[model samples]
Target: MTSITIRNVPDEVHRALRIRAAMHGRSTEAEIRGILEQAAKPEGRLKLGTLLNSIARDAGGLSDAEARRFDKLRDRAPAEPMRFE
Candidate 1:
């Protein structure tokens, strides 16, 4: 877990934060956490999985039947555990 300390916040800003926190039914700290979380890692950000899917779509997208056939062709059995004496 990581901890951050914000310094010298203006009084009016702090009061507004408190009010917003109350409106959201959360503690001021929780409100700040949610705000910071959203600011830092936004919902609309391009995720790796999403980017890969987009790329796949651009490059003649993988079809369900192709995916099913791929799965059928794979080695499904669990791998043998390594013996390191």
Candidate 2:
């Protein structure tokens, strides 16, 4: 097997990765491998109608007008503040 080393990682980022690995019951190396696997998946090239149909099926079948209204509502919702007091 080949081995590699990462250098110059920021302290906070390293700590975050360690925390995530612990949360998922994996070694940091295994956690990194899982992340790389997900990142390497082919970008799905689904058409708009197919994607919408998939989402509607998951949500128990929204009509076309209902889906459009949901999209508008999602677009108009306010984004949360970066930090909450």
Candidate 3:
């Protein structure tokens, strides 16, 4: 296992870390490791379609007419462009 050293941390920051470690019932080193691990990990990506489908399912699904209306609205021409000049 590799090790790292973080130097020049402000007293206040160190104190805060100590307090947080005590609150979580861990050593300062373990607390820092946990924080680093959480910060370094990649978050899972949620697909919009999957999320909407889940919500729709929980809400008992959309009516056929509502789906058709959404399809028509989605098929409409693009809106006019805004000039920044």
Candidate 4:
């Protein structure tokens, strides 16, 4: 898990967070995490992978053998840095 530091929150905002956490039976940290998640990735948000899969399905999906063939052609080597003239 990654951790982040938030600095310089207003006193009123901090007090409101504590009150909201108490009301929801969550710790202040938990409440903040929930708030951040909802703000960033709310319910019913369009996801890239789902959208791509839907597009593929609409275009006549590839067979398992064809998919495997495509996968076999993928480049496994690391990308090289570009040269500057």
Best by TM-score: 1
Q: Mind giving the per-residue lDDT tens digits that candidate 1 earns over 1-85?
A: 6999999999999999999999999999999999999999999899665577567756877775765565578676767989999
TM-score of 3: 0.50
**How would you encode candidate 3's per-residue C-alpha lDDT over 1-85 as one tens digit per residue?**
7899999999999999999999999999999999998877636657565577567756978765765566566635556889999
Give a tens-digit lDDT track for model 2, residues 4-47. 69899999988999999999999989998788767876367565
Residue 74, candidate 1: how far off, in angstroms?
Answer: 16
Please tell me which model should have the higher lDDT, number 1 or number 3.
1
* Ten-residue stretch with the least lDDT total in model 4: 48-57
Model 4 misplaced regions, further than 4 Å: 57-85
Give the deviation of candidate 4 from the true structure as CA RMSD. 6.6
- Candidate 2: segments with Cα more than 4 A from true spot: 42-85
Give all TM-scores, in the order shown: 0.70, 0.45, 0.50, 0.60
The CA-based lDDT of model 3 is what?
A: 0.81
Predicted candidate 4 versus true structure: per-residue lDDT over 19-82, tens digit per residue: 9999999999999999999999899999665576567656879665765665588667767989
**In angstroms, how far off is 7's CA in candidate 4?**
1.3
**lDDT of residue 59 for candidate 4:** 84
What's model 2's lDDT at 9? 91
